[model samples]
Target: MVRENPTASLASLASGQSFALTGGTVILEDGSQSASDIIVGADGRVVAVEPFLDTSSCGACVDIAGMLVTPGFLDAHQHLDKTGVLRFTPNPSGTLQGAREAFAKYARTAGPDDIHKRATRTVERCLSRGTTAIRSHINVDKDAGFHGIETLAGVRDAEKDRITLQLVAFMTPHPGQDFDWLGKNIDGAVALADAVGGTPAVSEDPPRYLDILFSAAVKAGKPVDLHLDEHLNAGVHLLDAALDRVERFDMRGRTVFSHISVLSALPRRDFQRIAQRMLDLDVGAVTLPAANLYLQGRDYEMLPPRGLTRVAELHRMGVTIATASDNIQDPFVPTGSGDMLEIARWTLLAGHLRGDELSAAHHMITTAPARLMGLGKDYGLKAGARADFVVTDCIDTDTLVAGGPDRAFVFSKGRLVSQTATETIREKEDA
Candidate 1:
């Protein structure tokens, strides 16, 4: 029997009590949507999800009939430390090196309070747009040191109730610092972070740099997320070096490669071989189309490449692939809104993802990133998973991914975190 409470309200469910979100088209594990009722327990976890869950024991039943319910979006790769600093650190050249130089200059005087303020604001923006989990990479070098890591840790603690934040100790190279400096400071940074990461392509010696990162991760039993070959120069690549390190450290299934933009320049055969290697090792990939498209291909005059990884090829090959907003309103890419759906749209257009593959594109921001972040067993619509989800008027995945709906209800741990709605009106035209 179906039971509906006439006087129930969605806002009432935020009181940390038992509730049932009934009559919604819930996105299932395989990216399919079905009309289902999600029963959330008093402890703020999903109790059951079925066509008609027994909500007789629930305190409130809010019907979301005609709405689309999906797991909260996840961003697997982002630079929170550098977000929202466009005005303070302008990249006039609008190139990758220029951004790095601008940020390095700013980092000389950047304090924890400033970093915390900017990062917290970005987190709020991401949460309002339905991102409940984020894995942000913080730079750790002689120039930036531990300011970013410490400040983001504070942000994570303060926003624990609203979002899940994982920090990466991104070991970067500085001109004044040698490999010995990284080797000396990496373990401490890794100790303070949830994962270890670095840009191996920019290091003086790629192999030695990767060895230090992998060795630290192995010692700490932490996951590895690397910014690998984030350029168009296919002649100079580091995928082989990184793969060898993954194999040496036995980091299979716990490693992720972000922004492999160079892969698009490789021939089909070479791309296929590398893709197979990634699959065999259970390594994941995250494509940051927004940053890659902006920073790469600037040296070309005509027929410049899309400057994105082969997202379609990797997806077709059954590799664990995802997309993210790498740098938001920073020197790296000065335009951003902290919205994952916007990232999805960019991926669709730049990566040549067909309209028929909307579900796959949707997964790039939701399930695919969730899997890459190792959000295992507790990040879905199934029973016992965390009741973190977004409610929108879009009826299916295609409508949700093509362009997000104007209105959305974001819930974290069964608590209403954000509710956004937009209304537009224009003068009536002559009929």
Candidate 2:
């Protein structure tokens, strides 16, 4: 009975208590599904994920048979503070320059309350979409100053229960120039955020830019997440330069690099070599396909590139490759839904993931990002892990990837944070 309508079934169950999810086909790390009865303990941790569990004494059970069960999604790269601001802000050309210019204009006047409200909405939207974790980038340069950092910091704490929000203080200074504002406010942003990030593509002196970014993060004793080589320049070597900083700072496994779009411009041999280097350094790659697809390849007239990194190659090299929604309705790309599944769909299309590789595509949004953000100590649909996951109305990954499945329920620490069910309505137009 519960299988047909998980929303109504879950609604009848008490909140904050442990229960068993019976007969559900839980998605494994490999994207394959298995029939496993998940027994969430009273403490909101999974006690067992075995096939055909004896739930006779479960007291209460929710039959999730045939549903797609998996760990909650994680967005490794996001601009939460800038979400839903396009109403007033306009991006006419849809180029990277236009995005920066538009945001620069808006950021100058956007206050803390406004930033907070929009960020809150984005966080709530992500939570409802089964993304229980987010690593959002907040601007800390001259245009936005520390307002983005401060506003998102508050939202991080407020939404702590629903989503594990990690703020990365990202500097958006011009290439070859340093912003004086971050000099005094860098500590403040680092004090409130989990990591520090910067764009090396725009930095005229990429090496020097990385030095300042790496130094600040080291001083703050946090990991570094960088927006490296976000352009289509085949000669761009920020990825190689960043490896130096990561090695010098010994930040391997503690570092993540997003938007390595130029990596695709490298030759196959060089790309393979760099992929191995990334694995040896324990660094991960985060591809923001949604924003990249929109912002990149605009200058090219014919046969434009997908504006994405070599996701499959890096993954094949055992390098953690995660995908995320980088910007949400802001100057960058101008389109976002705060939904990781949507990002996953785009990743599949833009990244050229097919067949058996589909599971890897799913991993890009779920388990892969969790590992990149260092949240894998006890994650995934495993026994003794936190009972934080999502259920979509699909039998397998193929169905789920095809889209249109609502996040019937989202659980965080064994508490249902969001619940929804499809209510098909037939209506006639009133004359």
lDDT leader: 1
Give the per-residue lDDT of model 1 (tens digit) for 312-341: 989989999999999999999889888899
Model 2, C-alpha of 118: deviation from truth (Å): 0.6
TM-scores for all candidates: the values are 0.96, 0.92
The alpha-carbon RMSD values of the candidates against the true structure, listed in the order shown, are 2.4, 2.9
Candidate 2, residues 1-431: lDDT per residue as tens digits? 36677657866766666688888789876666898998887777888888988876665689977677878888999987688888777888887878877887898999999988888888888888888899998888877878888878887787676678999988777643554555666778788889989887776666767888888898989989998888888875777889988999888898898988888999989888888889999998899998788988888889989889987777777888999999888778677777787888888778877666767778888888988887775678888777788877777777776664754688887778887767779898999
Clashing pairs in 2: 175-202, 176-204
Candidate 2 structure lDDT? 0.82
The candidate maximizing TM-score is 1
lDDT of the structure predicted as candidate 1: 0.89
